[model samples]
Structure formats: structure tokens, C-alpha cells
Target chain A: MTVKSKHVRIKGIKDGLVFLLDDKCPFEDLLSELRYKLEHSHQNILTGPIVHVDIKLGSRIVTEEDKEAVLEILKSQGNLLIRSIDALEAPGSKENDEALFLMSGMLRSGQVLHHQGNLLFLGDVNPGGTITCSGDIYILGALRGMAHAGVEGNEEAIIAASLLSPTQLRIADIISRPPDEWGTRESSMEFAYLTNGAMQIDKIHNIVKLRQGLNVFKGV
Target chain B: MGEAIVVTSGKGGVGKTTTTANIGTALALQGKKVCLVDTDIGLRNLDVVMGLENRIIYDLVDVAEGRCRLNQALVKDKRFDELYMLPAAQTKDKTSVTPEQVRDIILELKKEYEYILIDCPAGIEHGFRNAISGADKAIVVTTPEHAAVRDADRIIGLLEQSHVESPKLVVNRIRPGLVKSGDMLDIEDILQVLNIDLIGIVPDDELVIKAANSGEPTVMNPDSAAAIAYRNIARRILGDAVPLMQLDRKPGAFSKLKKFFGMG
Candidate 1:
């Protein structure tokens, strides 16, 4: 039986089948049609070697009840699994996944570099230059200028530099200071991260051990 | 065609005008027809420094504004027959002359002179832009101080951006006592920071002040230490192998002791 529903559209992707749900359709009818399709639609590849499928609700707000209804309908199918359910319709999240911006050469005074995701600078950030980014920042040379990381208020962002003698540094809403004698230790590799609403800086290699030591202390 | 060199220091009172006057005079002494153009319009002091202030009948603005011919604005130097000074107008500010106007004036001067030295004003504003616009080469003057060196570095970057590649550095007003005592930046320190070719090092000589007050540049004095430095710089600009004089080392201990004892 061919069940033609106006609200339900199917797409075949590399992973599995993707059901594009329309928000105009009633939740009860949508779930029932999805269930009916899951049970009888063998030509749609619900049972063969394919194990999972994705559901994309375009411009639709899915509540907890709606999620339960979807899960309940998908649970009745024995071998098929729901891989992912994306309903927000946010822009750039998928396009900018793990995107990196690279800049090379000396950034002199009155120069500025702005990037959305992680910034990988292969040159020195001179005294009057600045770099601002929404994600993490990695500078392979000396950072003598200002670096504002986590510009989109991402508190988990980190800034690592080979020679971190920055004029100023900001991570999320927190500001940090370079050690007073930083220039004396020119080759010291350092990094900064937000901790307890404040930025903390430490040597790059010690961060892992410091976190592990904290975990051990919590265990004891 | 004559070489157009813009003498500029991003910071004021670092002897850019003085350097321009001295270098132009030094070049003229070697029988080269040199024309010194004062691009600092409002603060017109290059003429006064060169002792041509009283002879300024028609300034750069006069020539640019079509009030006088280009030769009428050229103030002849009293000391050297080949040397000349195109003085800036005292009443007008820097905007009275545009970059194109300055370039046109410099082009006109280039047809007559063997070297055209533009005395660029302090600060990287419209005036500095106007001065460096016509120049094919640049001479960056800086003192042995942090602020001066920093400004010099910025000027060098701007010069490179403006197509004046590899501007030579001339470190002025270096005190050997302060440098030897590790209290001030030395030539090597400045060279390390600016990272440009050092064309000259003019030591802190009282003769510069004496020469300036008399409205004659120090390069005209045959015996002044700064005069020798400027002369050597002029020779180097002519592609001569002139060694940078040791401005840091003082006279030997024996000479000092001899002077203290009032003996020769």
C-alpha cells in the first residue's frame, strides 16, 4: 500500500534514511505515519545491513513529549536505530565543524586578525598587533600582543603559545596576566584556560598532570 | 635622473630636519648639485637651520599654488654654490600642499639637481605622506632611545608599505658615556631592534648645537665629529665604502689621565 503523506519526506544518505518532518503536521499523525513506515516500508531499507536512520525536523521545535513519541515509534522496530535527531536549524554549526583559520608572518602594530573558529598563527604577534577568535588559539611563535580567545563566550577555550609574553590576554570573560619574569624565560611554552571564572596559565606539559593529580586527590 | 631621498623620523625632535640639511650640504660639498626641500609646512624650520630663512622670498606653497615659478622658490645656500633649499611656507599648514603637488615640485627639482633631499616632518600624518610621496629612497633618522627606536621601526614598516624599500637607519644623538655604562641603547642594540642597514651613527656632539644656532649645519664644519659622520654618510649614499665610526668608545685612559694632569 502506498501511503502518501504531505508532511513526511524521506532522503537516502550514506548513513541511512533521513526523515524530514514538517512542523505543520499534527504530532500524533506524524508519529503514526512514521511507525507505519517503519513497519511496512521494506523498500526504504529499514531492515537490511543498515542499522540506523536520522530524523531532521526543519524549523520545528520538538518537545520532550514529541521526543518520547518519536522514540516510542522507533522502539517498535526490532533492528532499526535512531542515529541523530537535529531540530534546531542552526546556521554554520555543521559548516564550521572543526574549522581552522591559519595566519602566517609577522603581525605588526595596528594589525588585527579575527577568525570564527580555532586560529593557528605561525608567526609572531608583535607588540601592537591583536588577534581575536571565537575558539581556541595556537601561536607557534612569540605572542607579544593582545590575544582575545573564546570571543563568543566559550569558557572552555584555551590559548597556547610557544613564547607567551603577551601584552594582554582574555579568555571568554576572564582576563589573565603573563608572569612578571616571562621574557626572562623566553623559550617557556605556556597555555591559558578558564578556571572558576578566572583565567589560569601554566606550562603546556603540566596541564595534563595537574588535572590527573586533581582527580587523584578527589579520589583519595 | 637625480635620487629623491625622504629624511623622516616618526617621532619629533629626533633631528630629521637636521639630518636632511647636513646630508644635503655634505653631498653638495662633494660637488653634487643637491636641492633640500622642506616639507614641514607649518613648522618651517629647515630654512632657519640652513641659514636660508631670510632669503625665502617664495616658499614651496608659492610654487605649488602657482604664485611663483619653481626656480623662484629655490633658496640658494650661501656656503655652497651647488646647494639649494626650497623652504616651506610659514603661514600655511601641511594640507596646503598635496602629495601630488609635492611629487610635481620634487620632479621639477630632480631635473636640475643631482640629489633631492626631502625634509619630512615628524609624525606619520598627511605631512609625512606628502614628503615621502615623491621619494625613491628613504633615510630613517632615530635617536638611541626606546621610544625613538620604536617610532623608527613603525616608520620603516610604513616606508616598506609605501614602496620605499630598505630605508637606511641613521642613529643620532648617541652618548658614549651612557652607552658604555649600559644605561642607554647602543648602536648594536638599535640595529638588533630595527634590523635595518646602518648608514651612519652621529655621536652626541656639542658642535651640532653650535652649528644649528648659527644657522649652518654641522656637516659644513670641517673639524666637528658630527660633520665627519655626516660627510661619511653622504659618501656612503654615493656608494662609497665608509666605515661606521665607533661612537661608543671614549678616548683612551692615558689620554684622559693626560688631560686631567693638564699635559698633552
Candidate 2:
């Protein structure tokens, strides 16, 4: 029986049951297996007359129709009900690291956050906190720590922050530090990027300068 | 519920034990039921600094290992009716008590006390982890030296990762004379580096040493400048908006003479 149906795995959680469906399996095969399991083990799975189960479609991009179809299959079982349905998190990448990540709180010294794609931070990176990403890095608060963008050698990646007074800034293979007199605590947004094998820091108002720098590098 | 605050400093001898003793004593003096826990197991000095060294029957290891009751291990302060100290075991290492056990012991203490201050051991080792296991807040102690401030930054990172919210800063043993003469890191400089809110700034006062030698915290001596600083910190802990003390030094006669004549 187990060999015939090897797609959906169900487990008991505190609030209710959780159905973890293998993304490699076909949607129809998973739905039928879920229906059979819910009908066969409803008494053992639930002490109550009615129960809600959460379906985690790991990495499977589910449309509204797919969600409705899954719900319809559970409704046919009569005993099980749908609580929450989680679908694929992001597009264009099989790995979750490619998705945009957002985090808040004080990123203190000695802590390093590495992301494969664009990262957004809503807190201060205090002194020693390091942010290393293969893509763009955006910070809503002060970025006083070390930020290394395009760790995988993506030169187009930019590191931007509301207060970009970092200890060190690295874009692709280029590394640079701000001048000694650059400790102005202004509330303006600043961004840093690599151009012509050097790192350049500019205010957000001078965004055209960044594009011009990139174009000049391309021309060279 | 009572607050469990851990006073920690990654670098040794920056006055974690001294700050714990003074702040705990000051809070108790302000009528808050406070308990000081010495989590620095092997090198226990909070008991010595609190002047309750003679009254240790059972230690932290005893309470954690279930050898004695929690109340049996607590050494009551003779000065304050509501203050208590849980002395660390002198013979045992940091591994004697686990973080979970420390949390359990603090949970029990929280019921009876209004404030629980854990004097953490230096370094990001088992003792420091155990000290912050049950802390709702943290107080990072540091001197105005480069090494101490760097270590404090590292400790603050660890504290943030452990979910200890908004760890306040206490710059200890700051020499105003050196700061005025451009030889020391002032409060502003340290604040710029650490980026944490300042709770207290204790000057390099002789009274702190004299009080510690007698096993009494500086907060008990009203004549001491460090005492006033600790009292202000304690009051700030109680949600009072106390202003920081002015820590400027008066120029001596030598500096005055230098300014008066171009060549003497």
C-alpha cells in the first residue's frame, strides 16, 4: 500500500494536522492520496467530529485553481477541513535564498547575514554586524557595519542604506572605506556600488550619477 | 512579573561584579525587592563585592543541582531588609549549572523579588550564556579603552542574538581628566561605536576601590561620585528620567601655567 502511494505525508501538530506534499509528485496524485488518507484515518487522526488541517505545498507554485481543487478533494472526505494553504514562496528560483528577505532589529557586531538574492533590513547594523549578499542589499536604518554586496561577483548589485556610515563597503571584488570626515549623522539615504574597479558612494538624490558611472564603466 | 536583568561584559575586570553589587544594592535601597545572582561559578566575586561573603551556606550550584532549596542558597543583605544574593560556588566550574537550570532558578526568584540582577562572567562562554538565559534585559559594562569597547560590541551582538532586548550601556571607571586631555574615549565616542542607549557613566573614583575593599558596594557611600552614578542608574531602571551626571575635569595649575606664558 505504501509503495503504490508515495506522495503526501501527514503529521499531527498542536493546533491541527499538517499535510506535507512532495513537490515532485503530480498535483492529482497528491490530492487523491490526501483524500484516501483523510477518509481511512479520520477517526484515529481526530478525537473531535470535525478537524482542520494545513496543507504545505513546498516549492510547488499553486494557482487559485490548484488551491480550490485541493479544498474540493478534502471536502469529499467529509471529516477533514482546510485551515490554511501555503504555496510556493517566490518565483524564478528553486532555492529559497533567491527570494527577497526582510529582517528587523539591531544587527550587532560579529553577526553576519548572507543572502543569495536581494535583502532588506529595517534596523541598524551596529559596528560589527556583516551583511554579505550575492544581490542588492537595502537597509531602512543605519548601516554602520560591514556590507558586502555581490559576493558571487555580480557587479550590478548595490548596497543602499538610510545612513550609510559603514566600517567597510565591498561590491564585487572592490573594497573601500569612507573618509575619516564622513561621520556626518544626516538623515539622507546613501548608496554604494562598484565602478571601474573602484567603489563609489553617493547620496540617493544623485541616483543619475550612479547610472552615469555604470554607463561610463561600460563605455570604458 | 519581576524583571531578570543580566549585567555582562565580554572583557574581564571591566567591573561586571562591581556594577551588579552597586546597582542591586541601590535598587534595594529604593525599596525594590532585589536579588543578585552570581553566575560566574568558579571565580565568584559578587558575594565578596556585596559584602555578604561571610553568609554563604549554599551556592548557585547547590540550588541548580537540587542539593539545597532556592531559599537556602540565598544570602540576605544585612543592610537592606528586602535585598538578597545568590552566591556562586567557588569550587565548581561554569558547566556545573546549565542555562535551563539557571532559567528555572530565576523563574523561582522572580516570584519573590521585584528585580533580579545576574552578575555574568566575562567571555562568551557557558557562564555568560547561563547568566543571560533568563534575562528579560541586559546591561553591558565596559571601560573607555579600545579593547574593552570592542569586547562590549561583541557581547552586545551575542545578547541581541539571544533575544535580550535593548541592552543598556554602562561605561565604567572613566577618567574625566584623560577624556578632557584627549587621552581617553568619552561617553560620546563610546556611544558612537556601540550605538546603544547609555544608562550610566561611572567616573574613576577612589571610593569605589575603598568600598570594594570593605566588601561594601559604592552605592552605600553617599560621598562617592560612583555611588550617585549607580543610584541614578538604578532610578533609570525603575523608569525614571534621570539625567546623566556631568563628568568634566577642572584644569590643574600646570595646564593653567602652560596657557599663561609662551616661554617660561
Candidate 3:
């Protein structure tokens, strides 16, 4: 029989498969449902070559232990290759955007990545590419394009990058100075935040001092 | 089996057709049997650029529609017997040909030609889809402009989505003088955004315009700087690691002495 519960659903995208887990459901219930599907009907989904499954936690704040548990359950199935674990926009912002969405890969031109909660992108953002996050945004690689933090108007949200030469930067509703005024590319790491509705650029070293709450958020 | 390489640029006037024509001829000059397939369909121009416009008895639509054999539609190049051109049908739109048809035609052409280079159309639409459908690899041609490089980045993203393995990049119509003056984007800026391996960089040369007007590709001119660039690209396609041609237009301090001494 089919697992009629919407807690764990396997969806298909262009490249491969995706596992969409319900955000409202308890973590234990979602895990059990996932295990049941894997133990029973995985034969229908996981056939032929290896399947790349990206698990999306919709605005659900899953701790490191919970992530490991999910990974273990998915890995128990022989044919599934866990591609990525990330978060997406929840149905509504009834609760705060606590889930941190993680993504790896460069964002090329004309590509815009939009996420609900805090976001961490581990690759370059080419010119014309965009990343809009409802919370803080961090880039492990260069950020050459556009980045808008606190899309839902969270003024405290900040954007940080290893190499922050963005065409434009935005925090909440405040936009940065014109691109030409930003001058040439600087290879050093930097962070952009809003002070009294004006965007300010600062070295990444003082990010924690400016935002004392980042420490509380970082562990997530 | 021979590899099918599609030359594509998301933006127009970035030298996709010119790149296709020159690279096809350069490969032919290297004694490799090459075919150029024009997938622009309604606005076919590869034939005119290749100087084989008058020789097209049948076009790609005719071949795909089963009205003629592939050989009958193929226009042999006047400069090289080993090179061929499959012109697109000017009357028919891109929808007249399907991706499946293009793939099948390319697969059929692969048996005879050592390299099949498909010239993709400008916009990322049906024409672009059909052009890359059968390509085993791809070559993205772009100019050293923000708009061109941006469109190139989009094309690369689409290529990856289509499962076409890493497409090589060719920066065409670059002017070193302007790059040095900071008036234009340099290869470094373009490469940074593109994030793909550079196959070649073609300098903007007046000879390219003259050759295209005469319905001849720059690669056949031999003395043209663009010709050398295209040759390097062809050799690179053949897996040769030829270094990029010298694009620095600033005459060396010893240029006059070297010219007087008859030294290259």
C-alpha cells in the first residue's frame, strides 16, 4: 500500500530526485515515515543506476544530530545517493526563518536562488547571478553578482562573502551605493549590513562583534 | 565514432557562426573530415559565411524530412574537399526541425565526418535546443563584453541542465588595446564569470569582416590573426595543447629593427 502521509514525499526535478519533508511534522514521525518508505517501496523508486536525492527541510530547524539521523536513514537504503540537504521557503512565515539552507555550486548568470531562512552558498556567484535570502546570507566563495539579505524585511540580517565585489547588495529594503561607486574588485573577505537604513561594508573579522546574536545562530 | 561539437552563444553578434565556419575550415585544413550543420533554420547564414551558399542543393529540413539523402543536402566546401556544410532551411522556422531529428542527423553524420560542428542560433529557444541536442561536447563562443559573458554564463547553465558535459569557452572579438585601457572586459574577467576552460581567444580583426563579406572564412586567409586563433581552436579540439595566440597589439620596442632585419 502507498504511504498516504505527506510527511515524506519523493519528488522529481530536471536533473534527479528530491525528497521533500513536511516542516510541521515531528522529526521522529518524518524519520519513521521515511524509513518505512525506504524499507518497503524503495524498490519502485530506487531501481537501475544510483539515484541522487536532495533532501529539503522546509523552514524546519534540524540540529546536527537530526541531520545525522536523517542521513543515516537515507543511507540505509542501498540505491540512494544523498546529493544535498537544504531548506526552502516554508508555506508561510508563521514561525521565524530558523532553518539554514545550504547549497554548493556556482550561481551563473540569469540564475536567482531564493531561500526563506538563513543561507550558506559554498561557491561563486557570477555577474548577473542573484541570491535572495530572508535571513543572513554567507558565501564561502566569491560574490560578484547581486545579493539581497532579509528579503522579508529583516533589517538585522547581514550578507557576508569571502570576496565581496557584488554588482549590488541589499539588506532588508536598503540598497547599496551604485555599483560604480563601489570601485574595483577587492579579494579580501567582507560583510555588508544596514546601519540606520544605509548599507555599510565592513571587514568580515568584526561580523561577530557587530552582531552578537550571530554566535547563537551559527551553531544552527 | 566522431564527436559532435555545437558552437553556441546565447547572445547575437558574439561570433557563433563565424566561430563555426572558421573552426570547421581549420579542422579541414588539418586533413580531418569535418561537417558544419547550421541549426539557425529560418535565418540560415552559416552557408553564406562558408562561401557554399550557391552550392546548397538541399537543406537540413530536406534531409530531416526524408526528402533527400544526407549527402545530397551536404554542400562541399570549395576550399577543402574534406569539409562540408549542411545549410539550414531559410523558409522554415526552428520548429520545422525537432531535437530528435537533429540528434538523428548528427548521429548519421558522425559515421562519415571526423568532426561535426553544429552552429547554434542566438537566443535560447527551440533553435538553441535543437543545436545542442546531439552534441557530445560544446563550444560556447562569446565576446569580451559584460552582456556577452553574462549570456554565455546562462548558456553554460542551460548546457549543464541538458546533460551536455563541460562546454569549452572561446572568447571572440577581443581587443587587447581596449582591455588594457580598461574600456572593455579582459579575458580574466570573462573567464571568472564563465568558469569554463578557455579553448581560444580571437582578436577583433578587420580581416574577419572582409573574409565574411567575401563569403570566405578567416581560417582560409592564413595571414589573419583570427585565422591563427581559429586554427589553434581546431588543434585544441583535436586534443593538442596549443597556447593561446599573442593578442597584445602593443608593438614591441624591437618591432622596427625586427621588421628591418626580416625577423618574424
Candidate 4:
């Protein structure tokens, strides 16, 4: 007897699985099909190798209810991995060497941005908004917010902002807020980095050079 | 339409019950129908604070569990014809009520009242979730202490995460003497950390205790400083731009003389 195999193309990325579903199929149907594929295949659905699922919704804006349903399915399957929806037409993957991401949007209160690479913002970091980066962060607008760079203990991570009036700033183990005496200084870029085992900020122009050494701030 | 406002403080003893009573009374005094829902089941104190404990024939848990009708559980205040109190069940636990039941009750109350003030229990647990589920807005009460501030911060975070927009701040029990001496956290300090709009600041007043004992909200007393502050807060909520009270002013001999003479 000959059996025809039902195959779903799967591409493994460094993070997890990238599953592409046809836009014609409804999301619910797609979920059921994926479940059936996982159950009948040699791969174990419970302890599957896939740790992440990036669904390419392709031109469709996933409704809140749809997102909840997707989350529910993953949760019930005991596979609560990080899931993200991406537009199929999104730009091609950029090289990891180019680690800078420039985001320009109002981060409303209560929203958090967690980036594993450098981040630059051209807008205000409103109160109650937070930015956590494993690399450096630079904000061109007022920083009346919280910023944590080098969160993964990267001491070399630096934070610079046009207006250095943050509620709190953290780089590695050191945390500091603008001194009250620094009260409303002129709008100029200030750089913060580890100095003498403590986080310190000074005029960006003063650092005439940047030395790439162990916790050394080479004057720019 | 009536709005449901949750009076919550993540930490205990920040005066949520007191604020609920004062705001409820203030709104009632403005000729609006108001009902206060006490959601702190098993530890009901809003009834005592509002001086309606003796009038409570049925409680919130009874209404939620279908043991009593909503109208039967509502306790009308003796001082205000339009003000009513839904006392929490002293015998039932927080789990006796669910968020869905609270939402249903609030929706029903909205049809009959202009304001529904829910007295939320302390701590960010099941009770807090149930209390806030039906709220249109929230007033977070906090004292000027490190622990209170930290807990308020956490609550603010949770509220934001749950998508409760525009949570206003009320710094209760502020001691002017401590603030003036830099011993207590000032309004500016709290505002800087919490980053929420300040609605009111109630200075520590012994009259508050006296008013609670008499089942009268301080907001009804014209001479009480805290009462005046609460009234001003009510006006602000009504979209009036009332200026915040100057709590840092020193009570010098001249001020005392002016008080004695009944002149500024």
C-alpha cells in the first residue's frame, strides 16, 4: 500500500520556527491543520523543538480576539513560547552586524520596549514608558522616562539623549537620575556610561574620543 | 451616564474608605444620584465610615450570590436622600464575588445613578481585580511613605497593564509639618515617581476621625481643611480647574490671628 504524505514546509531559524500559512485559509482552520500535522508527524507536540512561532499574517490585521485565540491554543498545548505576528511584506532580514534600530513613535504610558540591540528614538519617552536594551540607547527628544541600557551586564553600553531629564537611568549595575541641582539644563545631548564603578553623564562633546577598552570611556 | 470610579490603594490603610465616603457625599451634595459599592468583602468598613452600618440589611456578596436583590441590599444614607451604600458582606470572602458579577452590578447601577464609587480592597489580588473590572476610571490613594509609594507604583503598573486609562492620584494623610521639614515625601516627589495627574491632597486632620465617628463625611463640614480639600477634588472631577491647596504654608501667629478674627 502506498500512502501520500501531507507536508507543511518548515524553516528553522536561530530562534524558532517560521510557519507560513496560506492567506485563503481561516486562522482557526490553520491552527487545526498545524495541530494535526504536529500530532501525526514524528515530532512530539509537547516537547517540540520549536521554541518560538512567527506567524506571517500577510496583509491582515489580526484582531484582538484572534490574538487571544492563538494565545489560548498555544497555552493549552503547553507550548507557551514567545509568539509574534509579522507582515509578510516586511523588509528582508537585516544583518546582525548592523545592530541599530531607529524607532520614531510616541511610546504611550505603560508601554515597554525591550530590544537586544542598540536603539535610537526621535521622540519623547513619556512618563511611565520604559526602554530596556542590551546595547546602547540614544534619544533625540526629552527623556522624562526610564531607560536601562546594558541590561545584560554589558558595561560598555551607553545612553545619550538630547534632554537628560530622566526619572531613572540604569546602565549595568549602576543606576542614576539627573541630580536636582542639574535642574532643567539647556537642551543638549548628554552621554551616560560607567565611570569609576558608577554611572556618570557629561556633555557629549567633552568625550572627544571613545576608547574601546574594558569599561574605559575613550575621549571622543 | 453614571461613571464607576474605583477607589484603590495597593497598600492597606491609605484611606480608600474615607475617600469613597467623602466623594460619594460630595457628589450627592451636588444633586447627583450616587451609590457607593464596598468591594472589600469579609472586611467591610465603608459602611462604618459612611455611618450606614446600621442600615445595611443585605450586603454585596448576598447580591452577587443571588441571595438578595440589588435594591434590597442598597442602604440609603440618612443625611442625603440620593446617596446610597452597598455594604460589603462581612461574613463572605473575596472569592464570593467575580469580576463578571461586579461588572453586571455596575452596569445595572449606571442606569439609576450618576456616580458609582467602588471602595476597593487593599492589595493587588482577586478582590482588587474584581473591584476594578467594572470601573470607568480609578483614583489611587497613597500616603507619603516609601512603602506606600512603592505599592502605589506597582498598582499603577498593574492598572496600566490592564489598560485602565487615566488613573488619577490622591495623596492622602499628608502631614504639612513633615513635608515642610522635608521629613515626608512632597507632592512633587510623589508626582515625579507615579507620573499620574494629581487630583487632591488631603492633609492629616483630626477632624477626619471625628467625622468618621459621627457617620458624616468631612466634605460636609465647612471648617474642616480635609473636608474642603475633598470638596475641591469633587469639583475638579466635575471638570473644574480648581487650584490645589497650599499645604506648605506655615501656620504663623499672623495666620492664627486671622483665623481668630475670621479674616484672611
Clashing residue pairs for model 3:
none
TM-score for candidate 2, please give it: 0.68
Question: TM-score per model for chain B alone?
Answer: 0.94, 0.94, 0.95, 0.95
Candidate 1 chain A: minimum summed lDDT over ten consecutive residues — where?
Answer: A211-220
Candidate 2 per-residue C-alpha lDDT over B133-195 given as tens digits, one digit per residue, 9 for 90 to 100: 999999999999988998899998888778688899999999988998999988888887788
**Candidate 2 chain A, run of 10 with poorest lDDT:** A211-220
Docking quality (DockQ) of candidate 2: 0.38
DockQ-based CAPRI category assigned to the predicted complex of candidate 2: acceptable
* Deviation of model 3 at A132, angstroms: 1.8
Displacement of the residue A126 alpha carbon in candidate 3, Å: 1.4
Record all residue pairs in model 4 with backbone atoms less than 3 Å apart, i.e. clashing.
A207-A220, A208-A219, A208-A220, A209-A218, A209-A219, A209-A220, A211-A218
- Which numbered prediction scores highest in DockQ against the true structure? 3
**Higher-DockQ candidate of 1 and 4:** 1
lDDT per residue for candidate 3 within B1-264, as digits (tens), equals 888999999999999999999999999999999999999999999998988788889999999999999999998889888998999999999999999999999999999999999999999999999999999999999998888888999999899888687999999998888998999999988887788999999999888999999998988876677888999999999989899887664557357436534594
Candidate 1, residues A115-174, lDDT tens digits: the string is 888889997776667899999899998787789999989887888899888888998988
TM-score of 1: 0.75
**Per-residue lDDT for A1-220 in model 3, tens only?**
4566879888888878899989898888899889888888666877667888899988897777788899999888777889999964343453556767789998988889998899999999988899999899999998989999999889999999998888889999988854565555555888888888878777887788787766545453
Report lDDT (Cα) of residue A154, candidate 1: 86
Model 4 has a DockQ score of 0.06
Q: Model 4 over residues B1-264: C-alpha lDDT tens digits?
A: 788999998999989999999988998888889999999999999989887788889888888889989999999998889999999999888999899999899989999998999999998899999999889999999999977877787788778777466799999999988998999999988876677889999999888999999888888887778988898888888888999997865657557547734796
State residue B85's C-alpha deviation in candidate 3, in Å.
0.8
Decide which is better by lDDT, 1 or 3. Answer: 3
lDDT of 1 by residue, B92-201 (tens): 99999899999998988888899999999999899999999899999999999988987887788788789676799999998888998999898887775566799999
DockQ of 1: 0.21
* Candidate 3 vs. true structure, TM-score: 0.75
Higher-scoring candidate on lDDT, 2 or 3: 3
Question: If ranked by DockQ, best first, what sequence of candidates would result?
Answer: 3, 2, 1, 4
